[model samples]
Target: MRKNPERRASLLDAAIEVLAREGMRGLTFRAVDTEAGVPGGTASNYFANRDALLTQIGHRFYERLEPNAALIAQAQEGPRDRAKVVALMHELVERVSSFRSGYLALIELRLEATRRPELRRLLTERIRADVDANIDFHLASGLPGDRTTVVQLVLSLNWLILERLTLPDVFPEEQVHDLVTDLVERALP
Candidate 1:
């Protein structure tokens, strides 16, 4: 039988917790099953294999960010002399804080993926997609994209800085909004 959406989210939640508490070294189909209160092999049914499971976790990270992305798109689409990019970021910080337990698991996955080409591609794409979205936003903001090098540097900083932000997902949205926007505008041409 197909798992309900609630059950599926529960599985992912279990995977994140188990991976966080136990690290990649300890996560397994059985452990995820136990943590999620699903029967053994249930994880395998959804994830197919360990690699697939890890990959899904990475994908989930991006999915979690979609709300933030949508907000950014809307803000940019609206009228503003300044891009107000941080507005989007602040909204994202607020949204992510609730479902914020997955960062550690994702970081562990990145480390594990470094030695595994397949896994590396999964997380790498997540970063790339983030950058791509940022680039789209920057471009839509009417910024000059003449310097690819500078654009990349700023994009990298944005993602890494947000990643370092606390998870349970507490963050001062207003402070972060002001701080990040100042940093971006200062860095801009």
Candidate 2:
């Protein structure tokens, strides 16, 4: 196994692109290598098998989508009111939506997880932890509403992101910002 962290990261990122473009069935080592412009078998060296590749891609998806600390801090510094919650939600939508490939790949992983129990368990655990963290962050920030508010926002916002990425025609581009605002306004106290 190769110990080049940079190369491994690149292979994983390439795998993400393959997943986003070709879906789960297209995620092969050769496909990843071609996507990454690395020599054939490069991805195989980095990942043991299809499942290993999928699992690593799952982790990479979150790594690529992690929120910006500075943005979080700035949002937190503001008054912790309904408006603040709305702002945070807006930021969250913008951040997640910006990583189009990462989000799309995540959707693929989720679907694939249905048939693979290990993958399903991994996703379930990670998603639950993320939800819990969001709830905790919202409460500690003195944001309006409660756990339900956070959960509702998470659910609605994810669907919004899916619609935005997979079916832009479903909602006009300009309406997205307003929709996020409306979701927050309606979800929060």
Q: Which stretches of candidate 1 lie over 4 Å from their true place?
A: 1-6, 68-73, 93-99, 141-178
lDDT of 2 by residue, 1-189 (tens): 898989999999888888899988898999999999999989888888888888888888887777778977887796888888877788888888888998999999999999999899888988898999999988888878999989999999999999999999999799998999999988863
Error of 2 at 12 (Å): 1.0
How does residue 9 of candidate 1 score in lDDT? 68
Clashing pairs in 2: none
Task: Give the local distance difference test score of model 1.
Answer: 0.67
Task: Give a tens-digit lDDT track for model 1, residues 1-189.
Answer: 345777776787798989878998889989999999978888777777788788778877667656555565677566553455445445544565445557667778878988889989878877777767666766667644434633644554446444545331444454555665565566544
Rate residue 32 of model 1 by lDDT.
92
Task: Assess each prediction's global lDDT (C-alpha) against the native.
Answer: 0.67, 0.89
lDDT of 2: 0.89
lDDT of 2 at 2: 90
